[model samples]
Target: VPDITNVQVQINTGAPGYSPLETEQRITFPVETAMAGLPGLQQTRSLSRSGLSQVTVIFKDGTDIFFARQLINERLQVAKEQLPDGVEAVMGPVSTGLGEIFLWTV
Candidate 1:
């Protein structure tokens, strides 16, 4: 595969209070920039009578390598700005790790 110029990603699913606007089983998180990278996604929280969530993203990946980089960047930026106040979001290519680990070995 060629070099992956970039990748686009977001927090899909489990976004608290994100259903009203993005009513869907899988909801992508907000992003700031295209090149910007986000951390791993965590569960949403209900704190202080407020609704918020976290979404992570990355760039390097096995898929989306080549071509669609520029376009993906645009989307990332938009997602970031569009995030709600209580919603903490990030941007980047989606991450896929088939690798398994943390097994108790005797």
Candidate 2:
């Protein structure tokens, strides 16, 4: 298990040149509702800007990264229809873990 971990989910409204404020208003409720009651989901923070929304899910220490991602994916799938047309949620890079970093001193 990694010492620290998080999963980032990005929601994008396919409508180009859309207003972030408007999009955020439409998505805020649905997205938050969708994220509720998910497993291993400790806390969530969200940001909305210019037709894009980002949510970061922080899990308790010792949670498996693979399971965390799977849980996120499943929840997002259920939330998809609730979002506006063309809106899509994507899971961020699984490889973002600090374990992927290498410190080498020569």
Candidate 3:
């Protein structure tokens, strides 16, 4: 496991083209709900809109998507029962182009 700081960012996707991204999403959260433990974390983004929710995942400098996906898949498999039904979660590429220019823009 690599060193990581716990960051949690809650984003509103419906806010005129809001896309999740690094640092912006890694703010802080409950221990179990964090992604630092998953490894190969280049970035993370969580989007909630119109009742739909999603997490955009990114890999680190030396990590590959396949490995990251596998780890995420296995964790989800184990957490299937723990998570509420109807909430579809999967590991997908984070769209940098969709990311915001800055962590915050007043």
Candidate 4:
């Protein structure tokens, strides 16, 4: 199987007690907006929960994952300015669904 070209952006609102709506408004939207217009970007899906926001960026098939991540890394710098103090967005590990080579069951 071929590796999937995708990136996951995780936002951790350091402070707790944030409601889902607030997280969506403050974290998710800004991140999604920052990711807009990226080359080879297929779609972006986001999930906003209390104190956390997860955005998955799916690129077109055959897109270079490294280049995609670089684009995201640069954009995230700009998005940081819009985020609240202490809140930080970090990209998840670079792994695809079929990248795993080991499987174990206990």
Candidate 5:
């Protein structure tokens, strides 16, 4: 398989106790809106939970991962402005399916 060409955005609502609907409206939607129309973007998937929102940005095959991340980083700046105070949207680690070499069971 090819390297995983995707970027993930994690949003932590520092203060807890947020409902799913609130998280979706206040966090997920805005983030999704910010990511729309990104070049080389294939599609985006998101999940809004109690205190967190995860947005996975998938890019088309053959697209450079580094370039994709750079685009995401720039867009995140715009997203930050629309986010609530203390709520930060950060990128997840750089990992690929082939990076998994082994699995250990304890």
Candidate 6:
């Protein structure tokens, strides 16, 4: 089995009461810039709406789960400082191949 890990980040796009589109526009640039050039990052998907910005990071196969989580957190730590005011980046739960158990064939 491949050792794959998923790291997700969520950030508040603006102060309370802002419109969703406005909030997304406010934080999109900085958030994208912050997550760029991350090591071991194989792919990234992002979503922004209703004052919420979420990013999912996928690491390459065989990447150490613990190390991958730590690496992502470290990059996010620095990115936090560069984010727009009132925006806070928070990491989601750690997910690895071992965390899944369902198998099916169709």
Q: How high is the CA lDDT of each candidate model?
A: 0.37, 0.66, 0.44, 0.78, 0.76, 0.62
lDDT of 4 by residue, 1-106 (tens): 5544354433334326778899899888999999999898888988888878888888887777788889989999999999989888888877765444434321
Look at candidate 4 and tell me the lDDT of residue 59.
Answer: 83
Task: Pick the winner on TM-score between candidates 1 and 3.
Answer: 3
Measured with C-alpha atoms, the lDDT of residue 104 in candidate 3 is 52
Q: Give candidate 5 regions above 4 Å deviation.
A: 1-15, 98-106
Worst 10 residues of 5 by lDDT: 6-15
lDDT of 2 by residue, 1-106 (tens): 4445454444333435658786667665567678777776688877777767777677776678778778777877887888778667677666545544543321
Which runs in model 3 stand beyond 4 Å of their true positions?
1-34, 92-106
Off by over 4 Å in 2: 1-15, 97-106
Clashing pairs in model 3? 7-26, 7-27, 7-28, 8-27, 8-28
Candidate 4 lands at a TM-score of 0.81
Clashes within 3 Å, all models in order: 6, 0, 5, 0, 0, 0
> Which pairs, if any, clash in model 1?
7-93, 8-93, 11-29, 31-79, 31-80, 38-57
* lDDT at position 67, candidate 5: 86
Cα lDDT tens digits, model 3, 23-104, are 1232212112544567766666654443444555556655754666677666556544544434334543433432443345
- Please, what is the TM-score per model? 0.29, 0.72, 0.49, 0.81, 0.80, 0.65
Stretch of 10 with least lDDT, candidate 1:
41-50
For candidate 5, list the clashing residue pairs, or say none: none
Show the lowest summed lDDT stretch of 10 residues, model 2.
97-106
Q: For model 6, which pairs clash?
A: none
